[model samples]
Target chain A: MGAAGIGGGTVNLYSWLSQFFGDPDRRHGPDSIVHRVGEHLLFSGEALGWALLLAVPLGLLLGYTGKAAGLVTALSGAARALPTLGLVTLAVLLAGVGDTAVLVPLVALAAPVLLVAACEGVRSTDPDLRDAARGIGLTHRQVLWQVCIPWALPALLAGLRTAAVQVIATATVASYVGLGGLGSYVVGGLATRDFAQTIGGALLVVLLAVATQLLFALLIRYALPAGLRRARD
Target chain B: MIRFDGAAKRHPDGTLAVEGLDLTVPAGRTTVLVGPSGCGKTTILRMVNRMVEPTAGRVLLDGTDVAQLDAAKLRRGIGYVIQQAGLFPHRRVIDNVATVPYLLGWDRKRARTRASELLELVGLPPETARRYPFQLSGGQQQRVGVARALAADPPLLLMDEPFSAVDPVVRSGLQDELLRLQAELNKTVLFVTHDIEEAVRLGDQIVVLREHGRIAQVADPATLLAAPADEQVAAFLGRDRGLRGLALRPAEGIVLLAANTPLDGWTLAVDQEGRPTGWQRSAETIRQVAVFRPGLDTLRTALDSAVLSPARVAVAVDHAGRVIGLAPRAAVLDALDAAGPDTAAGITATGVADGR
Candidate 1:
């Protein structure tokens, strides 16, 4: 935190980041930056998990059969325009409660991005590979599972990476309804005029988002098939 | 034997891909369905595997309707190869080859062992087995495709333009490998191609096709070349097919002159082991010595060598690349006399100048 230096020195953004990461005092205390980050991640992860479960199979089916693909394109375009806060408020009002209230909007925010990516990924798999699989005696389901799915993994991972970041950022809104995420610090800090706590909380969320991005980048590097990796090279 | 009894295919848009295609492909032989594009060669080949079922009539594999067989089980029992190899990019070369065996529930070790052996059988280097398909050259990848198709040791193999994607040199090499494999394994092959030259080279019974899967003629390469069924078939066969026919005839009967004999002031050179090095004329050495194996090579190769040689004669070598003797262009041309009327008339009409 950019804490006021006692007497002579003035703290900078670097010191605030350092304090946010290092010190166990103030912003770094229990129920502070680390604790709030953990809480934020839990909310993001659960919402993302639910979204993936519901969206992935549906997306794959749409992509494979080539139905509603255009609708997804239109829907995904529309998804970006809808405000996340408004969605959360609307969901809370309608659902009238708790963890599910936060989750509904967070999932709504995440699923379309993942769904569109998965559908397009699977849809764009090489026709040659598909023909070869069918020609080589694979059953229809086997072709989809063994060849189509593996070939579409790059798209799937890309979709997951995008959704993961979006969900993480959106989960902060949970603090609006007295939820205890990193967002709580921002919401509480503004209410109590504690700007340092707000900056520290915001920085932790940004750090988490960057880490998620890098994690997906690593997944792309090590988890992708050698052939596709060679293509990247 | 595989038989197509009036097999036909009409797409939903009402375009007839094949119409009343009736053909019998014999066992233990390479039957090539060859035509221009849209002639239904591939459609016919796919019908055997039931990949594209016939709209009418039937395709029977060994007297059993292929339509009646479970497509997956049928495909597992028969090998299929396609253009650009259609290889699974994710699989390593060895795993690609082992695909069918693995599909058939062979243990991993057993499947891989067979795959490695097949890699060698296709004349690929042993190190190729571990590399991914993208890492291989076009020809090497096609070899892996062949190895994969043969993994299950299927009684029948369907090949669709398998070597067409490679350059002529690699195409010929792959073609020769297929012939060698066919000779050893004797899998009944139904190969399809648009190239007439490949058809003549690889086909034991070449089925010439016109549009709409119509069979023009089915005959051995030599017979097809010697006597085409119609002017259309003859035109497709090309005007110079008589000379090309010598490709199928053995060069064994062609007599060779002593290598010591000089021609065009150039003397044939040899290494200590009797393998040909080049042609020697005065102080200069000609780097390219077109040599052919008399007992093993086709007569066309001997003639080509004779024409290519600066000494105005082909060098005949034994299997070890040891120089056996020399063949003058005239003698090589005269050997065509032994091929019956077509060969004799070709020589009589064109004479020696055009023959070279």
Candidate 2:
């Protein structure tokens, strides 16, 4: 199913490129290619930056404090289960349909996954290590910060990667709510019955997802401790 | 200078971990609390640092009650070592050792410097300072635990089966280190173990507790071995009490005589100063050597000397380390034979015979 979808989208992208640039009969123009690539880059960067800033602390907090975890998890679950279109509509109503509307729900959808992953990571830390920390005269706060957090960093970062990918794909849905994301071409193509434009937007979303995943994978490669990374290697 | 007076502890569930107890642990010596599991030996050690509070009475350090001191502050002043070594896995060995000193507010540089010094003191190399606890072997981890406990140089050290988790060879190594430390530092120490042999080897004073937290006996190792307070105490000390008793026998004034001249083939001869002597071909061939100090050597030594000798005779000697007369094996046997069939009486007399 995934391959067929990409195949169908690729056909649309070819038609759109031919038509928008005045056909293969004329020479290809540099400006349209640059415009498309720039737009993709800008949207991906914004979504990634927001996901990291919001998800890391949310994950840490949910993982560390038992009292707040259940409620935070439920809220994340609720946000995740909401239909993409419905969330974008709600975001539009709340934030008046711009970058704010697109970024808000994207973060909301991503936070819960990262948060749950982080909590499990921290929870699974060896009990012996914790006892040893206490026995060595580390205050509770020190143990949490210096021992627990650093030990859980790899798992937490993997969670962030997952959230980042989800945000990238879901951010394109913002175009449907008048946010002018890569999704705009797809929605406009459907309105005008232009298969080329629709396919081009769909292809862009897939490429964006793959590129973001690669970026985060590389980030984790360098960012996590050598011991943790070696486990993967 | 640690004392447990009328100390009692009952768990919330009503299990009596310890019952009314009074113990005075002399400073500068090792006092061992030994008993079966659930006998409160560990509870007693914990109470010294308020790890387990006494339900009924006070645990006093020097003269002040431990209860009045803040728990954490009290712990910082008392070095506590547990069976598993309880080393922090994330921290390097040096940082683990520096824990108490760091908590007591020493600067980081000073604390780490002292930690390295203590690692060497415990017979670990300076290279060990950079390794984490998990990176080290069990014995090394235990040594680090001991170094950590000794970091603050506390006057009182509490060890709760600290060497019990290691292999026998490692345990012996640790025991020797502890002995050396006690000799040099002269810290008041409370040591707890379930192994009676360990108690006999390490204790200056041994307090044996029975199951269910009752004191079976409290005496010096020699007295405890030679004359246990009751059958339970005897049973707890195990079947090897007689063998253990040998280690407690005082060597002071036990006879040693110099051979006056070489003699051929004879097991009995006379040494210089007119003292009768027993001679063997070599020191290795002599199973026992009896000391005769004029007016001081006990009958027990005289008897033991005769019994252990291959020649079956003990030489009585003057204070000048010269032989005087011979106590034949038969005479020693007669004294033993005359002591009656009462074994307890024989032992009690042995203690008295040694001038109490």
Candidate 3:
């Protein structure tokens, strides 16, 4: 824990570097780094899927109706204050340790970010646009789908990017609830006194977050209306 | 035809936007509702399309009550244009123009074809169809707005200060374009504007409104300027209403003197194209020779030319811009007298000339 620790930590930089690039001895069979990376993605992706399922329609509805806007902001603010560890612990106690315990807090973590983004995206549609759309004979439903949704896509995607990054970072807590994901290394490393494994696992999570951000960045670039893209550039 | 029979709109706050309004907009003609701000001219225009539902009364389109019609369907059958052009920022110009057609469930190819036709009709270049609204200037956006409104070929058009956001030069150009389009298409248009000059220039029948959509006067452009209902309307028409009235009359009736006739000590100079170059008197020359076309130009143009000319005679030209003859200021005045008192009462040839 003295000179062996680099940057005032017990983890050796040389060991951490080798572990990051080389095959790990700890993971056997399906628990390999590649397999764990996939599990981590699946775990975080499920959380995001659940968050989007719950938040998107609700956000679109609130945004289109322009009702309960304050509630969205308040909910997002309160969700931001939630401690992932505490939620995971409570979820485990209430529902028993499983995917549900790991997922509950991560979904809670991601949904509000998405909900606020979706709501704001739709709500920020130019009032003049709504008026013109209706005047030009767009039905209420048509206005919502044709005008509001397309206009909201950029903001919604932006929110998705933010939520995806947060969910990936926080999904490490899955290891706390007896789940298999990239978080296995950190929890298992700490237990076995293998600090290099902890650092390498943490680095993998960082890589995953960056990858998600880049993926969404490309989606936003391609998915935005051509006019919107031109305007931004 | 659209009729507002006792149409009134009272807001939830008990504010009257338009009170007990009774008016009829004739079919296939331009009717402009013009007044100062807060006069409810826009409200009156919106009523025809049911954008503003008359709270106390009904608006009738053709023989049926507009209130009874499905609002979206009714709006689809009537074109609506507003200030800021209100073009969808996300759509290409063609797609924006094709909105109504697309909403009507027309096939994409057909809608786009109609949109392209409309863009050309509104004087936009073919390439403009591929660009977005923001890529164009304010005036071009307005042209696209007009094109979009006309895409479905609706029988009626509602324009709420459609050209007000543009510069004065562009506004004039748009007004000219509207006039040209109106001549060819003859759609029933209800235009709202705060500018009386715009009302006179574009309206077949101008309705001057007071506060709360009260009708101050409704008359053809000439009569409205020549004879307003009261002092308020006269003031609203502005101090130059008489001179403005001349713009509505044709220059057809003026008696022209021979092109070769000599003015006292002054000679008309002509270029190789036979267009008047200047009025020459010995070594001195007045290079500015105001000219007008008798068949195509307005009485105002004729009068303006005569007043602006150094020889006090308007040079008459044909379509080719070659000299046809000349109309002295007196002859122009005589033509004004022949037109009738309704247009000539407050206006005098000297008054117009002196104003310059």
Candidate 4:
């Protein structure tokens, strides 16, 4: 699709909004909105799950042992410097344009945030608390789980939300290769010059990102310890 | 008993944090390591808990090598109190106290029950049990720290300048509480402090350390004040050794003059509650009355009150804060002389005994 075709196409922002959100039969009629948003949710959720499983524990471990903390910092810096679009495209080329290619880059993109957050959570725990925990007879493992991780929860939860949103926003590129996600709308709309569909899909991703942020806020609010849950004046 | 057999610490940078030394900390008594900053007093105290591992020799608790025990298990068996109390900010005061019990697998209800009991034991208001550590004052937080340390009822407690961070007024109050608690609990307390007054006040035996953890003196407070090992030890004890020494002697020896008798033309004025209000002369209230309890207060306090009075007499008060009698400065001096030579060792040997 050429830029001229996109420019010449009628871009009815209201029509796109009606079809994507307001109108029932034409949009919510077949529940395609649900289908597409679910697919987007599934992809980001998968990426977040993988990041949590792989990165959070390692980050926390590095925090507890502290020997690998510098390594986590360096790796987070290196990962942030990664060119996301280039990485996804290169991954598609190397891994033959499938989930292998797509998932790898997504995990790489998301894991670092969670990793760094966990590291900081562990590192920033009050020194006195650590001493007290140990002095009070908690084993190293108990100290991490009962004291350190719980204390670091606020940071880790924030990291989780951040990685989830980033994953959702970036997943739009995946449909470039014919994947089933909200990205498919943008790719499919542009190919046929369906400007409304393209704009609709982009807006949906933004909505999902905003929703994900709120979801995380809720999670953090509930996950925090009782004493900390109350907002300070 | 805690025994240190040539225990020493040489850091990775080749700094001798504490030199090898042999020492025994008797059970059921407070053994204080007091000295100037950088004298390695802290290092010596940490060594008992294996926080600072000794490079040579070993530390034994009740004849078992501390190094052989798992660090966490060993630490759990010991109560460790630091400066500032170190209460967990994220936890409620009760939960903070219940920390060790929770780790020991006490059920929530059991742990919390014990925790509330301890909050009361530490003199915290019952309402403070559910509050966070930050909501409490520095003095209250310190009391919580003590409660937390005693939670698992560890027979030994290691306090590193635990009272030094508070105002002198609160610091002494906390010291008094610790002594009162010790009288009842009788845990073997290893307290660290740079203040000689604190050492003389709270320690049954004071280990005065010089640079490199060198033992300048190892004696009871009286013995230590009466006879420092050398000039360095005496210097570290500070210039007011005479006044500080009186801190170790109880006020019991001084004869108390009946409150009805006026001294040097000055009379004790009493409030409606019978508490000493001040010293009144024929004309007006000349000074606020400084009173010391004969059995409960130290000789230093008795002498202090007498010296501070315009008529040079200290009033004695009962537990109710009512005026009981007066102690003349001459009588205080006579009591000291009767105890023996002003040497701490002499007074201590003469059985002017005290314990924290």
Please report the candidate that would top lDDT against the real structure. Answer: 3
In model 1, the Cα lDDT at residue A224 comes to 84
lDDT of 1 by residue, A1-233 (tens): 34564233345555655654464554555565667878899999999999999889988888887888999889988977788888878888988768888998888888898889878977987787787778888888888787777777888999899999988877888989877788886787677655556667787678889899999999998988897667435
Q: DockQ score of candidate 4?
A: 0.53
- Highest TM-score model number: 3
User: How many Å off is the CA of A165 in candidate 1?
Assistant: 0.7
DockQ, each predicted model? 0.57, 0.16, 0.74, 0.53
Q: Where in model 3 is the C-alpha error above 4 Å?
A: A1-11, A24-28, B344-356
- Tens digits of per-residue lDDT for model 2, A1-233: 11122344656556565664453422333324345456545765676677667766666655655456677667777777877667768878887867777777776677677777767666656665565455444666766786678667778777877877787777767667665666666777677776666665677678878887898788877876543455333
Interface RMSD, per-candidate values to 1 decimal? 1.2, 4.0, 1.1, 2.5
> What is the C-alpha local distance difference test score of each model?
0.83, 0.71, 0.87, 0.82
Model 1: DockQ score = 0.57
Q: Assess chain B of each prediction and give its TM-score.
A: 0.90, 0.73, 0.94, 0.91
Q: Among all windows of ten consecutive residues in candidate 4 chain A, which has the lowest summed lDDT? A: A1-10
Predicted structure with the largest DockQ when compared to the true one: 3
Residue-wise C-alpha lDDT for candidate 2, range B150-224, written one tens digit per residue: 999998888889889889998998898988888888887889999988987788778888865577777777678
Cα lDDT for residue B229, candidate 1: 85
lDDT of 3 at B88: 84
Residue-level lDDT of model 3, residues B261-284, one tens digit each, is: 888777789989899998988898
| TM-score ranking of the models | 3, 4, 1, 2
The pairs that clash in candidate 1 are: A1-A16
Native A-B contacts reproduced, model 2:
0.12
